[model samples]
Target: MNALKINTFIGRQYDSNFPEVITDAVPITNPLAVDKAYNILEENEGDYLYGFVSLIYNDVVIFGEEQLTECLLDTWSTFSYLLESRYDGSKHHIIFLDNYPYINTTIQENGQYYEIQLDQYQCFLVPIEPFKKELKKEFFNFVEFCKNEKLWFSEESSYRGLLETYNEIKISK
Candidate 1:
């Protein structure tokens, strides 16, 4: 069995010469940090919710950073494409991150599994069903979080489109 996990964090924007400086970060899973993180996201609406996301496989961090500045909405939007691709039977997909190093993760379907590669040296095989299950769960949970917080984008048509896509994927084989 392959162990795959996705964790997202909410981070505060800090003044810096470089755009990647985010501080006082906290995981979305942290109950106490939820409101505080939401406040930071609300205040920095123009900045697009500075955040971080990590992909862990079998206890190894495939990609992540404590200070990396990632736009929460955009990252989720990008990841949604993977679900679409998988549903459409696409053999190959690549997810490009929006921050430093500009690393792109590749996912290639091989039979009942996806071979995910972070780089030449880091690769893992995960069964397709579990990957979809975890991704969908996290995506929907984040959407619910945004809705409960009454985030501005939660009402946007684009965000609604994501919810629609998620529903479609959920009912499909």
Candidate 2:
């Protein structure tokens, strides 16, 4: 089994124009938890949803809190392309978030492993199959959650784009 693990949370920043009202992070354990988090954010009149995601390998934090400001759906949808890169013969994939406190994550394939770098500083190598397996599982789970909540129909363009890409990725896989 691969030692790589992915953890994520969803939270909101209310009153985003003036003073920000940051909500506590809600652990993304399942589809219901993500739905509940968004529902609560909507109820509280949040401007948007954002969150943190970490990649842990063998009990070490490869990517952590510095990346907390990413828009959850947008980041995940972009990150999903990493999986596609494996099959498309693309050597490297980078996920860059241009929001406040910018985040840049790069993943490059080397032989049977993928070397992942965060902000050009932190780096680690994870076996290709395991990394793909974990990422695909995490992404599909989020896609299922989006479908269950009808986000493609009710939410903004980001959600719609995510669903569209999800369908493409599913069909390609």
Candidate that would win on TM-score: 2
Model 2: per-residue lDDT, tens digit, 112-146?
88877665556778888887888888888777865
What is the C-alpha lDDT profile of model 1 across 60-147, one tens digit per residue?
Answer: 7765663255466666765667777444545443433355344555676779877776565677777778877887778877767766
Residue-pair clash count for candidate 1: 0
What lDDT score belongs to each candidate, Candidate 1 first? 0.64, 0.64
Worst 10 residues of 2 by lDDT: 93-102
Estimate TM-scores for all models.
0.72, 0.73
Which residue runs does candidate 1 get wrong by more than 4 Å?
12-15, 18-22, 66-69, 89-97, 154-158, 170-173
**What is the number of backbone collisions in each predicted candidate, taken in the order shown?**
0, 0
Worst 10 residues of 1 by lDDT: 93-102
